[model samples]
Target: MELYFLGTNAGVPTLQRNVTSIALRLLEERRSIWMFDCGEGTQHQVLRSPIRLGKLEKIFITHLHGDHLFGLPGLLSSRGYQGGTSPLTVYGPPGLKAYLDISLAVSQSRIPYKIEIVEHTGGTVFEDEGFKVEAALLEHRIDSYGYRVTEKDSPGSLNTELLKSYGLKPGPIYGKLKKGEDVITDEGVRICAADVVREPKRGRIVTILGDTRPCSGALELSLHADLIVHEATFAHDLAEMAHQYHHSTARQAAELAQEADAGQLLLTHFSSRYSSFEELIPLLEEAELIFPETLLAEEFSAYPIYRRQNGQLGK
Candidate 1:
């Protein structure tokens, strides 16, 4: 899986960065992409990246903030106009359905596909065969949330060589064995799948947080995550202001990552005051001091989530 940062700026757009938007590309896992937040001008950001509107299967809105959801309706409309015929589901806090309904109704927009809006308060928001998504209430001005996407463990590769020793040739029987089924050979010998199959491969975990102050909810959602995307709307020097605004400072975000024991931290939703690259370096430095694995998110940057040799997740 890969994370594509569509926009990394906070609240408003700048020449260097746009608002808060992130695309979790799952082409290899699900043949679709899941968006974290769709900020203003997000569709334009997608156009610039390799992400396709049609591939967006789900959108999880953290809050009703305009910077996080203003582009949602426009993106949904554009999805239908493009080649997105598949059904789309959106998960968010309460009042999201009303917001989308009114926005679409007022605009008289026509969508070719069905859209399912799930208003979640907390707990598991979505779960399927391959993945499960959980939401936790975060500390923000409004009722905000953080999401943890967990990929389920998968069966390891079939040991064909070991199976061959038991006189099992390449056939449908191998398929059954790969599915963890005990099959009786043509000679009446029973073969257990566990005897030949390797251990299951561990899945990856990704945590994405919305605008919030450093709180326990963030830690709970990000516990042992392979990659964490946290908002750092201010520098270390502005901790007091950040707390007042219900935002997190770079140092606070980094401390959260360290406390959560996450593999890597990607600090995003930067304040526009630090628009220039030079100005943002101090924020990065402050974070790196606390967590060396921290990275300052840049617009349009894609980060890869890799699995370690022992089946654990890393950056």
Candidate 2:
């Protein structure tokens, strides 16, 4: 899986950064992409990346903030024009459906594909055979949310040599073994997956958080996450302002990631005041001091999430 940062600015757009939008691409796993926070110009941003609008399957919104939701109507309409035929589902807070309904109705945009909206209220928002997505309320000015995505563990591949040694030919029985099932061939030979299959492969976990102050929800959501996309809207010196505005500073974000034992931290949602890389380096330095794996998120940058080789999957 790869995470593409389309926008990283907070509140509003700047010359260097857009607002907050991220695309979690799972083309290798499922040939689809899940979007998080469709900020203004997000469609345009996707056009610049390798992401295909047609492959976008779902969208998750953190809150109703304009910087996050303003691009939804335009993106939905454009997806239709771009020939996206599959049904699209959007998950967000309570007012999301109404907001989309009114916007589309007023605009009279006719989308040929079906669109489903789910009003999320924390905990297990979505789960499928391959993955589970959970949400938790966060401490923001409004009812913000943090999402944790966990990929289900997969059964290992069959050992062709071992199966052949057991005089088993490749066929539908191999399919059953791949699913971790014990299979008895028509020849009356029994096969156990545990004896002939490689060990199970561990899954990966990622957590993406919206605007919020340091809180228990954030910590819980980030626990053992392979990569956490969090908002660090201020420098360490501006902790006072960060508290007043219910936003986290770079130091606070790092502290939470450290305490949560997150594998890696990618800090985004930068305040406009820090306009250039030079200005942002100090903030990144502060975060790295607390958590060495910290990284400053940049627009259009992609981070690959991979399964751990050993030990727990987090720091």
Regions more than 4 Å wrong, model 1: 187-190, 308-315
lDDT score, residue 181, model 1? 92
Question: 64-113, model 1: which lDDT tens digit per residue?
Answer: 99999999999999999889999999999999999999999999999999
Q: Write the per-residue lDDT of candidate 2 for residues 176-289, one digit (tens) a residue.
A: 888889988778888888888898877899999989999999999999888898899999799999999999999998999899888889999999999887899999999999
Q: Give stretches of model 2 more than 4 Å off.
A: 183-190, 312-315
- Cα RMSD for predicted model 2: 2.0
Provide the lDDT at 206 for model 2.
94
TM-score of each: 0.95, 0.94
lDDT for position 81 in model 1:
86
Cα misplacement distance, residue 29 of candidate 2 (Å): 1.2
